[model samples]
Target: MGFPSLYGGLTCLDFANTVDGRALPEPEEHLHDYADLVRWAAYADLLDTETAHHLALLAKARPQAAAASYTAALRLREATFRLCAAPPAANDLALIQQGYAEAMSTATLTPAGTHYTWTLAGDHLDRAWWPAAVSAVELLTTDRLARVKVCASSGGCDGLFLDISKNGSRRWCDMGTCGVEAKISRQTARRRAARRTTP
Candidate 1:
């Protein structure tokens, strides 16, 4: 339907979260089409409403370019997941480094409120994917990596989150979805175990 909630906290990580699981064969991808991708980008603050509308139209006019951009986004998304989900090996590290290099190449240092910020440049079809790429790089190169966590919910929700909690014990990608689901599941299991023990 509409863009999903920003459960992953950061735009880039949220982009990686367009899918649900890590198991092979078929993770639940939310970006079915270019429009979906653009909508998700807009939700992530990578595209303004006006720019998103223009990009959506551009995607319709130039399907091939749109498809290419979609593919690039997915590749970066996977690379980001690999970087965060576990201790990346040489290849995984290289993929992330390449993604970061690409993002940095297109970025320019600009003044924000009181500090400088990296802003993406270019009016290309793939520009929509840069912000998320930059965010992925930022997360990877910071101390925040210690806070990154995969969801603990069972049944393969497979969401990731930056646990910004004070104690860093925050679990579940979303209390409404995975959180509630896990609670219900634990309760059901306890009930079943009780029944088994009872005559």
Candidate 2:
């Protein structure tokens, strides 16, 4: 009933999925406002508890700034979506690179466990989208492109996901929803065909 996170595995690319079925009159838009964005950040592990609380307070205090952050987040998501959906043209790649550069400019590397991780300081609007942007850039530049997949459900689900299965056969964003529905649909079709062919 709440905002769906079925495709959160893809981080920023998942944000592109907030609004689905573009042709429908009422598309499923998860990021209705700044609060929704924070909810998504929590799901993505982009915001720690302290930063998230501060951001929520900031949103309440400066609604306009919050709106701008939401808009910027959407733009970065779109750029990531396009890059993942296909091989980007020169212009498309340039736009995504520009976004990645901007995000990296505000982030600092901090040692976490045994590896270094990007961390942003304070609760600026920039921080709202920084982690997600960094994640998108990481996925794009790494060797994971071969495993990036768009949902193959016939119900027109446009969820983007990473196919990390052994056989690389992962087709649905979540097996419980679109995958189950598609399986049921296939079984029903087979039964109908069998009945029609019976003597």
Candidate 3:
């Protein structure tokens, strides 16, 4: 019900993981509504508390607009997942391009200690997903894109993450959850095989 752990190591990838069990028949959806989207933006540090509150109130006031924004967010999230974890599709890339353009149109170049960063301005409903769009574009354009990976748990997690391991051997999204489950499953399989052979 609550947002999945931020194991993706990137805000955009985490946003993609807002759905659990992407490989399952029916994945679990965490962002059920516009308010949930705002809360997720806040959780992902994409929005300040005040800005999140403002957006939540704005969503309530403009329900139809908020619904449209939510639909766009979901579109961006799926496009990000495909672009990061599979062979890039032209349509997916186009969606990301449109999202990035829209996000950048409203972004301001703000000073951040030593350098400037593109900060989304205003409390528009799309504020919840603008940073995600920007982040997806940034990651896709960088060499770090090589580090993006999909979960390898045999239980079929299908979560996306940036594998920052020294040898790039990380296979699971979380060592404590998917990793453990896979390890246990393998051990059980081995034990069963051993039993069958012994008999």
Write model 1 residue lDDT over 1-199, tens digit each, in one string: 7655889888767887888766535777788877788888777778887778888888889999999888877777777887888555567656656766877887789999989987775456677777777677788789998898898877676688999999998889999988998899999999999999999
Tens digits of per-residue lDDT for model 3 on 1-199? 4789999999899999999998898989999988899998888888898999899889889999999999999989989998887666679988988989988888889999999987887667898898889989899899989999999987778999999999999999999999999999999999999999995
Q: What C-alpha lDDT does candidate 3 achieve relative to the native structure?
A: 0.90
TM-scores for all predictions: 0.84, 0.86, 0.94
Clashes of each: 0, 0, 0
* List of clashing residue pairs for candidate 3: none
Return whichever of 1 and 3 wins on lDDT. Answer: 3
Model 2, position 25: C-alpha lDDT score: 62
Candidate 2 stretches with Cα past 4 Å from truth are 6-8, 21-26, 86-92
- Per-candidate Cα RMSD to the true structure, in Å, reads 2.5, 2.4, 1.5
For candidate 2, give the lDDT of residue 28: 69
